[model samples]
Target: MYVSVKGGEAAIDNAHRLLADRRRGDRSVPALTLDQIAEQLVLGVDRVMSEGSLYDRRLAALAIKQARGDLIEAIFLVRAYRTTLPRFGFAEPVDTGAMLVERRISACYKDLPGGQLLGPTFDYTHRLLDEALDGDPEVEPGETREGATEPVSRIADILGGEGLIEEEISGNDEPDDINQTPLEFPLSRAMRLQSLARGDEGFLLALGYSTQRGYARSHPFAGEIRIGEVEVEVFMPELGFAVPVGRVQLTECQMVNQFKGSAKVPPQFTRGYGLVFGQSERKAMAMALCDRALRAGELGEDIVAPAQDQEFVISHCDNVQATGFVEHLKLPHHVDFQAELGLVRTMRTQFEQAESAMENKEAAE
Candidate 1:
């Protein structure tokens, strides 16, 4: 039995109004500006952009404000807005090798080429909260060093030269776009990377942590993590060359994991790659771990954990989709509940009538 109940128009309107009022809060304090959100809440904006799969910092900040500092809601808003935008032709893949390096570090080698540079990171800081941040505090200017004349050599390349690491295969084949095509099983590495790049930070972090805790241990080492700005260029058909469009900050991680070779090949370190739209080192690192874990099959290792399952991770990694399916239960299901309630009552009544008839028969006998 299905029934539709109407007459909540006014209620819905008022509820929306109430929500707006709550979002505004007490009007005595000055309202937050988009610039303040974009500049001060940089990490939040970065997360929104990374998860939303959009790079516009300003738009991300606006979504953050509209969502009342709820990052997930902001991500949802940005993704919704992204669908309406016009698609210009895809840009040529940005070259990370030529990136203007800001922060470069390696855990495997302490004295690698281009030396470790720790640019604005919380790695060395104490976790204690400082009350001084509550008020405006003057910040000392950061020390500047002479810029490198040439691109820094990647650690993977150094290892590759000695045959200590697996070689990265390059192909001219056009990678499948997840946006255009529905995801199918046994996804290409390119498609998997696309899905993982936009996956929820917390979810990836958990999966990555699981790998570290021996659920699907890879004996991973952070070969290198570099954060910098890379120039984006689009090919001009009329001009016969690519022109620089803009530069976007990015974080890239290369994880080296142990691989025992089979009959055909010798043991060599395997590599997992992670890249994101902003200076999101944590997300990048986590993505790298999960990426390596998902390669269990290719590496001839057993897939004994959730992180090793491609379908499980790819299907559930999307926070927006997960939230939508979970939250939809809050919507009215009164008709279905009512049908269940009626069925239970009818069964109870029938049982009571049968009991009464049995009692009467016993008494007459």
Candidate 2:
């Protein structure tokens, strides 16, 4: 066992060196620059930033590079680095309504107030890759319109006004920081949202898919999805005013789900909300679905599905925790194996002795 441990240590060191070499394959080829990754692989960086709970694009890009494009690994790296940073001040809640929208679309309405500005979406693009994009090419800017943008109204709010949707009441309570405190049962909507925001995108995506597949029945329509830049503010107690800290690109998704009238509530459109960092439309939409599913208990709905169970979903959502438990199986378990072996051998010996005594008693008879 001691020899095996020493050999394992040497093997691990060699494996790390080999991995480093493979990560930097082909020395003749130009290495991927951080700027290129930040700009070109923006979506990858966005996922890392969103899941890591850190919004630094540069750091996210670096993590992506170090992890060799493994997004979950990159998220883990970013989170580990984020833990060491000192807390400054918390930013005030962002006003999504006043966002300078880059892309705004709705499946609920045909024509909204601002109209669907399909900005920079790959929805209409062909799936085939263009070989021309393989090499560095100068990007040409497209033509712009001169008309001023109009104020966009939320589809859910419009429905609520007409008594077609559930009333979304704002709460004055401050949200609990899950990072600072351990998660307890009966979590608030704010904590659930925070958990989902930092949750594994793939896990959330699968859970969201399960809801659509009749696991948790929901008639969902994209209420509104907007990708834009919103101002971040911090309240200065001394000045008694909120000051602008900076602007961050965000993707906000609102899923409008059909609800049946229950004993306590009327049949109205209940909405799910998802707000994530950067242009992650799919992740945000999936989060909205999962968020709505998790609200089953609060809404007095049946919790028959895995997605509806807060404890189940929240507990398994963290990739860092999931990965650690799964990967730890590779480590040596000699002590545990020895204990199991002893128990099995003892059971076998007892069975054989009992059989021998029965045979001898039969012979004597």
Candidate 3:
């Protein structure tokens, strides 16, 4: 148990006040509005929402503003606020195949049914920083085409139809919610996906990178990455029908990994799925890699890498928990440190006495 340090209340209060003052820094400059943050720093807002497990863009912007641009702190604030809200009902599984495509690409196929739409991507851009961005300049409108009249076919579906890739089986069982129950080992694929969806982007990215470097390599290919708005629906008990609530922007990635079949099974492409809120392509791709890496046991692959360890990945992937444990070390540990210091001093004295006694005996002899 930890005891709070008394007599530091005034100091703590002052520190909080100072933090507020710093957050507001230089009143002469115009303060940033929530609209600017939500619209301009969209990626940051998306990250906070994804990790916080909350889907409020406005609230996420507010958290980013309050946390002074610290995405982790913004996520923590959003999560804390989320816990206070009551759940009305769960939404039905989103149909990504019908997503209003803003951007869609596949590394596996050069020309698919829905020709590649490179919408607002930095893939072809030179890495050099543009000096024009430092000044307010009129931005040129991008070329537009008529929106697709019908839903585009998913690449995974095409692959599955040809019997080239494993088909995803839909089940009647409701997936477990991590928020409602504690995570136990030997987690279901649904539970693992849930944990990874909200896992730290940096942590997942590193793990994903490690896999590419031959640590539990799963000869992966980005089968498809589509980003757009998907209609969300909730089943209404009163109406006996599902009603569309709203559309949420999502980035969905399907990674095709190589799998050598066993005696019973035939050689076919395996899949790693990632679906995240907003346009988080990097996060979605990273999630897919980690998701595939964690499937070692079920796939009958040797679990020799850290990424393959479900317990380690699931336990340490949460940035909130990791941050709390690491940051807590800054708190006072006076009693604990005092005991260690005393013990060390006693050992030093005993060692010195023993050394002196040996020298005297050697001289006398």
Candidate 4:
């Protein structure tokens, strides 16, 4: 007998309890503190912040712990928390020229006005196991006060020094947030970039790498890759101007691409831009590459490759949405199975009737 598989509600309750126990784990081990997760697993926190679009380190850490160190789950947790937040208003545009840069480098030039600063990066590290960090906990350094750091001028200032690259100019435009509404076509540059920044790290990485591998074949030089904290401001209409709301850690990339001498001008450089939450160089660079690829039609180039497909790039960027829908399949869906059963039964009946007719015809012969 099947036992009729009763008490689904009770079974679900028991499953939830089991999940809670599994998530909490052993009593012998120390409960994972938020600080431990934040300081020790900073990159994980950064990824959660980037994808989740929230900047709270402690909350991100808690999400990581609760998610069992699964980055996607951590991102989902932060995202879930983020939606509950009520916003007062929007911030004003931050000037990159005034950015207090921590790490700034220009691939296009060896020497720039501000000079290169390699603040902190894992690029040089040989990823080997270090038993020392596990043994000795070091004393904390004294906290340096904010704004003690100075602003850096960009490398683009050099090209603009000789009228080479186009200088950015503000126009009448405001972007719609992807989180607020579904992405729509005929999107302005700001909206497109916003989507790409919050998009999947792997998806952007693959799209960026595809260009270097001759898929899109656009020649690109990293005009600049900068990591810094930029001030976000609020335009207080009643107060008549913008005011500093807060500061956010950001990774911004500007790529200069080789443009053919068009009918209007001589051969020169054009730009592709990306800016993302937290310090995410790979995502920023990938966004820049994809940004350039999507500009093919606007820039008078062919739009045949995957990276060049704006619809494709913008459509598949968000990791939170993607991973959730995918992982949700692990939840109960017996209703779908019943539909599949009906389909199979109908097909089986048609096949058996056909087979029986063929067998009877042979017997008569």
Best by lDDT: 3
Kindly list the per-residue Cα lDDT of model 2 for residues 1-365, writing each as its tens digit: 53458657788899999999999999999999999999989999999999999999999999999999999889999999999999988999898888888888999888878788788889999999898888778889855434324346777778978999888878888789998878998888888899999888899999999999998967789999998888999999999999998999999999999888688778888988899999999989989999999988777888999999999999999898888899899888887888999999999999999999999999999
Model 4, 263-322: lDDT tens per residue? 986777778888877778888898999998888887788888898888888877888878
Off by over 4 Å in 4: 1-6, 137-148, 352-365
- When sorted by lDDT, best at the front, the candidate numbers are 3, 1, 2, 4
C-alpha lDDT of residue 163 in model 4: 76
Q: In model 2, which regions exceed 4 Å deviation? A: 1-3, 7-12, 143-151, 345-365
TM-score of each: 0.92, 0.91, 0.96, 0.88
lDDT of 4 at 224: 96
Ten contiguous residues with the weakest lDDT in model 3: 143-152
RMSD of each: 3.1, 2.7, 1.8, 3.4
C-alpha lDDT score of every prediction, in listed order: 0.91, 0.89, 0.92, 0.82
Record all residue pairs in model 3 with backbone atoms less than 3 Å apart, i.e. clashing: none
The lowest-lDDT stretch of 10 consecutive residues in candidate 4 is 139-148
Candidate 2, backbone clash total: 0
TM-score of candidate 3 relative to the true fold = 0.96
Q: Candidate 1 or 3, higher TM-score?
A: 3
Give the Å error, residue 164, model 3.
1.0
**Candidate number with the higher TM-score (1 or 2):** 1
Clashing pairs in 2: none
Q: What overall lDDT, based on C-alpha atoms, would model 2 receive against the true structure?
A: 0.89
Report the lDDT tens digits of candidate 3 across residue range 17-127. Answer: 999999999999789999999998999999999999999999999999999999999999998999999999999999999998989999999999979889888899999
